[model samples]
Target: MAAPETRWLAVNGAKCRVRTKGTGRPIGFLAGLDGALTWTPFLERLAGERQVIVASLPGFAGSNGHDRLDQHLDWLLATEELLRGAGLAGADLIGSSVGGALAADVAAVWPGLVRKLALIAPFGLYDEGEPTFDVFAVRPGTLQNHVCANPENFAQATAQPAGEDAMEWQVTQLRTNEAAARLLWPLGDTRLALRLPRLTTETLLVWGADDRVVPPSYAGRFQKLIKGKTTIATIAGAGHLAELDAPDAVAAAILEFLG
Candidate 1:
């Protein structure tokens, strides 16, 4: 696969990093707490038919500070600005984990901005019976265990170099976690249920059967909230990061939905 071209854009007075691949109708992808680095395989698959734009959230990867975005609504506005700045205002949108929640909010608030929506284990709702794991509290080595069902994918995603490189990676992860916590800590709910009804685009909700971070049951909740055309799929033997745990399945589902 060809390497994705990375570029920087100024969105809402913050520098945002965007990786573009292939060329065709635009598909904007929002990365999760771990960023878009691990989704290269998934993006590569989608790029074959459409232009794929992966944007890192503020404070992750090459993006600027996240502190300016104090609330989930701010993040939604920033995302809107980013997509418009990148000429993807009406692109098909896909997001995972926290990114999913952001994508949903953007689609709801600005229904025309997203032509179609796909969310995988998105974090935006809280279920009392199936509480989300407190990822911020988990110890370093143990956190990976809750991320994905496949051990091989988990290992590859969390692998790090030794010495200074390891330290830098740790810092980057910490910052990313901090940014995610701003929207998902304590309770992962952003009251997205209220806004979900406003989404007019066709929506796809994918969940991992073994997702511990956001619980698989939330998939039903999402289905109930979305007022538009919706479909749900569960990837067996997968966890929170369904795209990483079952990349081909997730990619196929996304392409099928977009088509």
Candidate 2:
């Protein structure tokens, strides 16, 4: 496979890093709390059939200009600019976790921007009876247990690089988490339910059956709230980051839905 082309774009006055690979109709992807600084196998698989364009959220994954967003409105506006600036308008879209919430928001506020939407364990709804797990409370070494079906995946992804790159990599990880906290702090819910009724795009809700960070049952709540044609897919043995645990399964589900 060839390397993805990288570019920096200005969106809502902030600088964002964007990447594109493959060819054909476009598929815009927004990654979870841990942004996609580089193309992963799961993304590469998606690129096999269509053009995959991934963008790092402002202030995350080495992107700049996050400071420009001071509130939810700022985020929403920035997201709109990001989509338009990155040429993702009117494209098939996919998002996971934090990115999922943003994608849904964009679809809701700007119904015609995304033709189809797929969300992977998106975090935006909260149920008091079945509380979402506190990802921040987990101990450093054991945090993966709650997010990954197999902890080794996190271990490998976070493995400190050798030599001069090690410190930079570690700092990026910490800052990424900090940036996520800005949006998901206290509780992950950002009242997305209130906006769901406005969503008109065809949607797919994909969840990891073994997810602990955001329980798989939340799929029902999301489905009920969305006004559009919505479907659900469960990947057995996967956790919060289903694509990381079962890339082929996630990719298959998304590809089928896109078709």
Candidate 3:
């Protein structure tokens, strides 16, 4: 299957890099780590099932420190406009990590716009006792290490022959952390924990069985709290970056639920 047709689209004070793939059914992609979406594999698997539009989303790297998108809610609003610009205003929402939090906000604010929502080991809940990963405070190495418990993925990413583009990405990752820390969740409630009760759209919750980042325990909370029908699936042999680790499973689950 062909990869999502990536493009550069503008949205409220920010020119977003958006990827539009497939055309039958529309589902928005929200990245978790680094904002540069890693949905290529999933896109390939689900190419025939539905249309997938992944947004690079306005952030610390591609963004220019605009005061308007400083608040998390504002970014969510702007993101919806970005999606609508990509011809996906009422499409299903697929959010991973930070994107999950944004997805929840969108469902809350525009209750009728979302057809369905999918969250894959998303962040932002900030459980009181469960260890919280401060995406900004950690070292780059630490972040990489946490991505895969096997440690091979980190070695693979680090060992891949270095190139000018890879170096640029590393720099972007480092700088974006600081800016993201400020605007990512300044208003708190990144999990939309309190707002789940009001969500009226059907949701599919995907989690990696080995996911130590958000932990599978939170799945129950998400399932129980959402007012809408929620289906849960666990992907084995996977960690936080399930799309990269187990893209096939992720794609199948998404296609089965959304298609």
lDDT against the true structure, per candidate, is 0.83, 0.86, 0.68
Off by over 4 Å in 3: 1-4, 37-39, 60-68, 150-167, 175-180, 183-188
Model 2 TM-score (2 dp): 0.95
**TM-scores, one per candidate:** 0.93, 0.95, 0.84
Which candidate's TM-score is highest?
Answer: 2
Model 3: per-residue Cα lDDT over 1-259, one tens digit each: 4445667766786666777766687777777664542334555565557777776666533443334566666777776777678776788888876677777667867787788888887665666677545555556477766665455654453342335387766655654555455545442346477778888889999987887767788788788878999999888988776765777988888778886
Ranking by lDDT: 2, 1, 3
Q: Score residue 87 of candidate 1 by CA lDDT.
A: 76
Clashing residue pairs for model 2: none
lDDT of 2 at 9: 92
Model 1's alpha-carbon lDDT is: 0.83
Clash counts for all predictions:
0, 0, 0
Candidates sorted on TM-score, descending: 2, 1, 3
Candidate with the larger TM-score of 1 and 2: 2
Clashes of 1: 0
Write the number of the candidate with greater lDDT, choosing between 2 and 3.
2
Model 2: residues with Cα > 4 Å off, grouped in runs: 158-164
> What is the TM-score (0 to 1) of candidate 1?
0.93
